[model samples]
Target: MSSSQFQLIKEARLKNNCPECYSNDSLELTIKQKLSETQFYKSITNEIVSDINCLNCELQIFPVRWTDDIEQVVNYHKRGLNLKTKSVALKPISWGIITFFTVIIIATILFATGVLVL
Candidate 1:
């Protein structure tokens, strides 16, 4: 089975106050991108997500509770982010599987045409 995970792309400390704790200089913002992995290949996807947490309150701050200023700062940081390009990388096992299938197909064709006998 394939698995998907979020890999950290960027982390920044924000000066905004946490709505829950009302503390400044404790808010942290983090951005992450999705990665999918399987036995055959690993892929980086374009899906991106962000999260905010307060160090003082040790709590996660959801977007519903975000103040206007906090939202603006988050947007600014997002605009400046340099995200990774999406790509896929095949494993050695996958290459072996492809080679095996190719060889089998070619041999079958040759036998049908009488080029390969017995």
Candidate 2:
């Protein structure tokens, strides 16, 4: 891992405990790095997860990452350091539903027109 990747993982591991896990007996953090390429050059991505187990309950939490004028990730966990009520965007599910229907419709049309025989 690169220095930046190590730093990100270290930062995530040192973060404070989850508010909901106040009564938990154990908590830990695991970090991972993924490399990718953009239009310019290669970049390192970081992902951190807090593993907590307490009172017969287990959970994982992640921190928020954002840049100027851009929001990368959103916090939607049930309990955490900054607990609050907020809007949760379920856009991915909507897109999946639309895409499923569109694909089926297109495939049906193609089959009916004998353009696609399988």
Candidate 3:
């Protein structure tokens, strides 16, 4: 069974005040992708989660704690953020199926032309 994993998609540090610790330039925002494979199948699903942490107090900050000034600053930075997303890659099982079909067709062709012994 494949276990679910959280991969860091994007990480950015903001020079903003931490509401919890009241520290300046200690906030960090991170976006993570949680990937999980379906049981008894090769299908995989991905979900996104965002987190804000304060390095000074080691506290997790919430959006509700953001002041108006902080909101404006976050919005300004948000406009500059270029979030690039990538499509999921094809699994090895799909290539294996294609190869199996190709080999079967080749074997059939060889047998029909008497090129394959027995």
Candidate 4:
């Protein structure tokens, strides 16, 4: 079974004020990248997500609550982020399974051609 998770890519402390609490220097921005994992392989996907929170208020600030200043800061931080590339890596078990199947197929072919004897 494959499982999907979001891994933290970046966290930035912004000087923008929280619209709800009206507190300055309490806003934080977080970025995450999607990761998929299974017994056979692990992969990083291109999907990215972000969240904003207020440390002083201990509340999550959704986009709907963002002020213009907060939005601008978030946009700046997002533009500066260095995101990871999407990639897949196979596990040892997956390699072993592939090798086992390849050997079986080769053996079968050889036997059909009368090149392999029992």
Using TM-score as the measure, which candidate wins? Answer: 1
Q: Write the per-residue lDDT of candidate 1 for residues 1-118, one digit (tens) a residue.
A: 8999999989999998899989999999999999999999999999999999999999999999999999999999989888889999999999999999999999999999999999
lDDT of 4 by residue, 1-118 (tens): 9899999989989988788898989988999999999999999999989999899999999999888888888888888888888899999999999999999999999999999999
The segments of candidate 3 whose C-alpha lies over 4 angstroms from its true place after superposition are: 2-4, 33-48, 98-118
Model 1 residue runs over 4 Å out of place are: none
Error of 4 at 41 (Å): 1.1
- Residue 44 CA error for candidate 4 (Å)? 1.5
| lDDT comparison, 2 vs 4, better candidate | 4
User: What digit string (tens of lDDT, one per residue) describes model 3 on residues 1-118?
Assistant: 6667667767778888788878988888886666665433343344566678999999888778877876776666555555545344556776787899999999999999999968
Worst 10 residues of 1 by lDDT: 77-86
lDDT of 2 at 26: 36
**Alpha-carbon lDDT of model 1:** 0.95
TM-score of 3: 0.54
Off by over 4 Å in 4: none
Candidate 2's C-alpha runs over 4 A off are 1-90
RMSD of 4: 1.7
Per-candidate count of clashing residue pairs (backbone under 3 Å): 0, 0, 0, 0
What C-alpha lDDT values do all the predictions have?
0.95, 0.40, 0.72, 0.92
Better of 3 and 4 by lDDT: 4
